[model samples]
Target: MIRGPVIETPRLILRPPLAEDLDGFCELMADEDAAKFIGGLQPRAAVWRTLCMMSGAWSIRGFSMFSVIEKSTGNWIGRLGPWQPEGWPGTEVGWGLLTLAQGRGYAAEGASAAMDYAVDSLGFTEIIHCIDPKNAPSIKLAERLGSRKLGEAVAPAPIPHTVWDVYGQTADTWRARRLE
Candidate 1:
């Protein structure tokens, strides 16, 4: 079985999803506003499936989003990390936090660690974030992470998303940005 690595940031612990996180994960995906840019709100059952999928991804792909735990409260705050399913647009490090967790810079902190792992550990040459055109917050976050809008592409259908704004930087660029 594949095991996820536990990654720690200044104020958060990035670890594999646990059964204890089900409620928070459900709440995040159930909120229309929270799920808007990522995907629309889903029923509890769907959310459970999603959680299982993320867990399964670790074993199947050896890499998946890390569950973000707030060090202060020990609560599950969100999930962010490397993700690349079959036929995915590209190697990616994505983020999605609870609505209450927005604007705290947790996404940036956790994602930075994930990106480092993607490059330095996984040996990925590039990383991308497939963002919806209308997601201003995510777009801003992508920019904050030194990723520029690379272009747009059609996502696989039935996902209800239109042309996606792909933002990314090469490994060299990522390293250079981190140094600055």
Candidate 2:
């Protein structure tokens, strides 16, 4: 498996997924509101597969979402990071946090680090976020990250019925914004 880098932010830790994250994954997926935009609610068994998928992505693809851990509590709050599964529109940095974890700016903090990792380490030239149109909070976060709505794209199978608005910024734009 890919021994991915562990990133420490002031309030969070971004690290690779492991078997131990199953319970946290299930908790996140079980909450309706938290799971709504993220492929709807999933059962525990399916969540196990999700955890396995993220862990295996590290093994097979060399990158995937990192488990977002709250530094103070040392709890797994969510997963957010670089992802570009088969047939994805582009290299992307995505975020998903549990209900309790929302509104704390964790996604933004962790995602910014993930974006840096994607560009600096993963060699991504551009980054995109496939967001549902109705997800106002996510749209705001993407905009906060200096991304604009570039257009729309349908996600890969298991979730092709819905079209997602793609928001993005190039590496140059990201770097320039960071300097400002």
For model 1, how does the per-residue alpha-carbon lDDT over 1-35 read when each residue is reduced to its tens digit?
22689998899999888777889898898888889
Which ranges of candidate 2 are over 4 A from the true structure? none
Across 1-180, the per-residue lDDT of candidate 2 in tens digits comes to 336889999999999997888899999999999998988899999999888888888878999999999999999999999998888899999999999999989999999999999999999999999999999999999999999999999988877598999999999899898888
Model 1 vs. true fold: TM: 0.95
Model 1 lDDT-worst window of ten? 153-162
- Residue pairs with clashing backbones, model 2: none
Candidate 1 backbone collisions, by pair: none
RMSD values for the candidates in order, in angstroms, are 1.5, 1.1
Q: Which ten residues in a row have the lowest lDDT in candidate 2?
A: 1-10
